[model samples]
Target: MSDARPAREPGRRRLVLWRHGQTSWNVERRFQGKTDIPLDETGVAQAERAARLLAGLRPTALLASPLRRAADTAQALADITGLPVRYDRDLIERDGGAWEGLTSREIRERYPAEHAAWQPPGGETSAQVAKRVGSALERALDELAPTGQLVVASHGAALRLGMSHILGLPEETWERLGGLSNCCWSVITEMRDGGWRLAEHNAGTLPEPVLSDDRPDAGT
Candidate 1:
């Protein structure tokens, strides 16, 4: 299946923000922030499958968080794309502090208001995460070839916040961009006007066309 779009003008590029596949903690509903847990068996399979499809896009550069999960996912792409993986510490998941390794229910029970606000007692703020991740992404973009694509393997929240920052979305509207599922990706294309546009969000593969004989198609 191909999700390739039309070629862009010279110097234009695309960024593929890929979230790492599921981990053991993910299955346990635990907060995995900066935990450095390796991908579970299913996650490795998911990455391999997704890499096969993403390779069709002919990505030029591969970047990932230094954490094990993200690194392993990026390595899957590297094996297929022959692109060396570059690790960026800034791409790491949000530091959940005291919340790390704790289940959602545990966090809520321990710190109700903080959990509601989605902030840990001693953790990095959303704005701080956005800044670091956005900066790292810009650096990756600088290294990309004109008209090339960069595949970024990172965490769910990190990618969402980073993409929001890169797109210049206000903090209030950031939540409008939902989180990505494991092994899913969001694509950003450089616009002609020197800005970025979200070409795809939480995309796992090319959509299969729906066919129904009874459906009407009267308009040309």
Candidate 2:
């Protein structure tokens, strides 16, 4: 979900991962996954802006999560990049298990400590979610024969955990990067050392966090 399909040429690969535009569920601040909601008007505008922003990237393959929000964003990016859309389930948001359609406030108010939905059990914690996401992205890379430019449309919650995972941030950092805006992007680069590194991390997302590299804690 985080990585793109391979490009036609090899040597160095560049993958641009963009979180998808907003949905009605997103706008209303609800949990989404298998929710199958469409983007709102503002979300459409956001996709258009994202399309223009990525228009000149010349990506060879436009990949997206199977979810409608992500698929829709990928379509717009495809139109701009002149590439067809490819769907990957790994790109999908965490199952969210029993909390697919509830808000955090609702969950806390309703289920409280008894909430199994608070943290996924045998499902995906932030680390597990990112592992699968990174793995799914790697699979996408392998599928594109001979390599090609790639773009992926993802979601904010997953992206938050993913960014944390890629940057080696702590689990407590989850809330810090959780509330990303629609169609925003946070880039990461594959370092020469083979460890993927954060590049312009959270460049086009929300809620500013003044960083302190000295204390790489959950400050985001």
Q: How many clashes would you count in candidate 2?
A: 7
**Every candidate's lDDT:** 0.82, 0.63
- For candidate 1, what's the RMSD? 10.3
Model 2, position 36: C-alpha lDDT score: 68
Using TM-score, give the best candidate's number.
1
TM per model?
0.88, 0.76
- Candidate 1, residues 1-220, lDDT tens digits: the string is 8964344345789999998877888877788888889999988998999999999999988999999999999999999978999999999998888988888679879988887787787988889888989989987887777788999999887888899899999988777776777888999999887579999988986421211000011100
Worst 10 residues of 2 by lDDT: 210-219
| Clash totals for all candidate models | 0, 7
The TM-score that candidate 2 achieves is 0.76
lDDT of 2 by residue, 41-115 (tens): 877778888788777666777778888888898888777767789887877777666666766457557766634
Where model 1 places Cα greater than 4 Å from the true spot, the runs are 1-10, 205-220
Measured with C-alpha atoms, the lDDT of residue 44 in candidate 2 is: 76
